[model samples]
Target: MTTERKAARLPVFDRAAATPEQEAVLDEILSGPRGNLAGPFLAWIASPELAEHAQRLGAFCRYSTGLPLRLSELAILITAVQWRAQAEWQIHYPIAIDAGVSADVAQALLEGRRPVFVDTDEALIYDFAVELYGAKRVSDMTFAKAEERFGHETTVNLVGLLGYYALVAMTLNVFAMRANEDEPLPFNE
Candidate 1:
């Protein structure tokens, strides 16, 4: 048997050829906060069922999470950097900064450096996300601090948010989907 390489397939969503299921999912995505069909949705629509579920989860993680948007965006940025998902990074970086994540911290992450966080909450979030990615589990100390600060429901939401964004990152990377090809890449050379 010949070896088959898994070449990168860029997301190319064509509206006219969409199946009924894809059309339904596309409608949901379009009517939501994201008014356009770009990013992971283009890749995800291939499996309309997965697209439907993931989009719901994404909406909850992005919009209804108990953690503030600032913290949620920070976690998303961390996930983006961890996955080296250029599209994810490019999309969320501005949102993170606008939601109160410091420019210095964002820059440091882009450069793959440990940032000196100014806010205690930002530090805690960074530590939590970093430890989770590094060790594949959060240390007890890290978990306790997160629990004490945010409580059970919100902490779960944080984890869920991390998970949802991770899915997004993977989809983006695998499909070679980019938010804007004209824009500079977020990672260092």
Candidate 2:
């Protein structure tokens, strides 16, 4: 009996030559996930591909009903950095910037420096991510601050962002998803 183990393939969408359906799904996913998948989101209908989940997550961030968009992105960025998922970090850094995370703050987070724009809300969110990722729960003080600044719905969404990105970071790392060789690291290493 032959027993050779084949290598696992990394999950990714070939953006250059995606099928029409795939392209459509990618577009809808990139657009954010408010659809029922019965329409434009059909491309991912019932699909369990990693890209699908990633798209759903992207949509969640884009369409989140609670947290401010930039804050949510910061939470995801923190998870990406802590998990050391280079691809995730690189891909989302621009999104974070677009969503209003300052370039310097994003760079510092990516580069392991203390955040340069530590306002009350930013620090609260950062601490929330750190405690949640580190302990799987929030301390009472962190929870209190989060509620004070963002209320309950945003707090719940923050937790959702953490869980989503944790899965993404682990998947990308295990698959050894490297950043495009041409793309520079999002921050100085």
Highest TM-score model number:
1
Model 1 clashes, total count: 0
Best candidate, lDDT:
1
Model 2, 48-110: lDDT tens digits are 365566676656754674777788778878988888777678767877889989988887887
lDDT of 1 by residue, 168-188 (tens): 999888877677778987865
RMSD of each: 5.2, 7.5
TM-score of each: 0.92, 0.71
